[model samples]
Target: MELHRNRGALVLPLVCVLGGAALLLFARDGAVLHRIVGGGGVLLGGVVLAGLLRPFRFAIGADGLTVRLPKLRRLIRWPEIDALALDQPPAEQGRPASPRLLLVPAPGVDLGLPATGHHPRDGRAAVELLDLDRVREKPAEIAAALTRHGGDRFVDVLGLRQAAFDTSDFTVGLRGYQPDRVDALIRRGQDALVWGGTLERQAARSEIERTRAEGLPVAGRGYNTTQVDAALARLSGALTGDPSTDRRPTT
Candidate 1:
């Protein structure tokens, strides 16, 4: 596989350069706000330039994968890799979302992250998936290289999940909203008798069962998959108790 750079790395520098120059040049005739903005611009320019010059880079090789982090570079071996996925861009569509590469390892590989190493699909191990965004100009080339080097099988995250979800749904409000925490609210609601605890627990159990059936590992305490799913189910159930008219089944 080849090394690929983020598209933002290039554009960020140009912005820094142009913006900093404009601010510095106009500082004399500027107000207090302009001076403050110019000072911030200078600092931002330095930072942006550094990032642009030394961005987070990844390399695909016959041996394994390598990431050039800001502090230092990390190398991963092939045997450590369990599942690999790539998010390819849309075919001749609107702006492309940045691609991602996920690497799920066999148990006990120690991906260095605290979470369980399950692949996102199976959710078995707390898998550490690497995300790469902002590169769309050479998608096919990147995909081909990744396929050739990283292996052929990859969950096409871009085409599958992204296409399925409406872009409009991802608004500022949604971004700020945490969907995972719906469980706590549901639990609170259950305690308040807004919904029965048994029903909420049943929903959680259903989720736990479904995840287990899919080979996903049991969700542990605190931000665990089970908690999130259970919460969602509880909320769903509360929202649509009467399915005949609701059409949307309650969790």
Candidate 2:
């Protein structure tokens, strides 16, 4: 599968280029201020346009992954990859408001890909970043594709859990399971899905049972008992290796 660039992002640069040209055309010959502004606009717009116009290609094939960008172009064979993680970049003033894909190479193997920055989880590893905000494909789609092609290499750090629970809306009722307890248990289950191992899976299953047995605290305004129970049952099924409830990629 080949990811496509976000064409919508081109609007600003296009506007800049056009507006700059217009300013240059209408500026008075003797007006230094107008001339400076016009020239600056054109230069700024041109630089940004050039950067945007650079060829960007990301493709996944049976044999390897292909990444073609302005400064990097290489086919990373499957064997060279140790792990492919989806990392959530911190929300900042001038950062992409989307998760990035990290290409973590195997030990002693250097693909020479440029590093945009360091991921907290990957600390000091020479991992390359693939910004998803620039790509038109949804992050879930990309994750699915990577999981399908990369198999065990894909480590879902954040997207999988967020995708599963971020939109969960349980019916709020006067008498029901405590929202905090249910949410905490659910988070543990989700984390197990991401960090899969026999031990972790078993622990998650045990926790689900213990939580169910102990019962959640009741609150005046809480999630519906029935809905919460159903959700936990499904989560337990997923932890217990029930194929029907298991939506995540196998570790």
Candidate 3:
């Protein structure tokens, strides 16, 4: 997977170049030193701009999953993956709102990130989780891709909920079925909409809204485990004609 944080990395450099040029033209100290400094600023600005346009990669290769930072010429291998953890510590603990992805090394696997003082270094001095972006955006797509190419060697897709909570280690969640299955259920309901099953679609919609209102973690769009299980139980009971077994209310 090749991704780029195009918007984020370009804004500052553009502003700096424009500002520097303006300063060079109007400043009283527009001497040789100022020209030289302005030239250097322009060069650095181009470099930063190029880095933003370039694609960053997350590829599953013959050796393992490699995260490539083309700008930095660095590759992080999966065997070096120690712990795939997430951090959403309470804000009171001084943690940020969104979670981050951390890369922990395995027992013997030597990831070049720590030694280089930049895990998955993309020209940054420190290894930070914010480097990997759009993680939660396409969990199901990522899960399916991993299964197709990586031969199930990647993290288990079903255990993502529990895996999302590690502190010290890097935890990779959404590999679990929570997101994938829930997404499937939601799409199924949406598909029903085409067949004029409006009531069934509404049921799915209500399930989604209720879950969000309840403050339960939703894995993917319209994929709430609690709602799915409850709906499934009700459907099965209905098919069996066992009214006693049905948990849904009678209308």
Highest TM-score model number? 2
Model 3, 108-220: lDDT tens per residue?
66444553223221222333333334333344444455445444333322224223111122122442224433433333333333221436545655665555456444432
**Reference-based TM-score, model 1:** 0.49
- The segments of candidate 2 whose C-alpha lies over 4 angstroms from its true place after superposition are 94-96, 119-126, 163-250
Please give, for residues 18-124, the per-residue lDDT of candidate 2 as tens digits. Answer: 88788889988787787777777778878887887799999988887898987669888899887788876553432224678887777777777665655433364
* Structural similarity to truth (TM-score) of each candidate: 0.49, 0.63, 0.38
State which candidate, 1 or 3, has the greater TM-score. 1
Against the unseen true structure, what C-alpha lDDT does each candidate score? 0.49, 0.75, 0.44
Angstrom error at residue 172, model 2: 25
- What TM-score would you give candidate 2 relative to the actual structure? 0.63
Model 1 deviation from native, Cα RMSD in Å: 12.6
* By lDDT: ranked, best first: 2, 1, 3
Top lDDT: which candidate number?
Answer: 2
Please, what are the lDDT tens digits per residue for candidate 1 over residues 170-233?
1222123232333233333332232234554456445544543563322222234444555445
Error of 3 at 61 (Å): 6.6
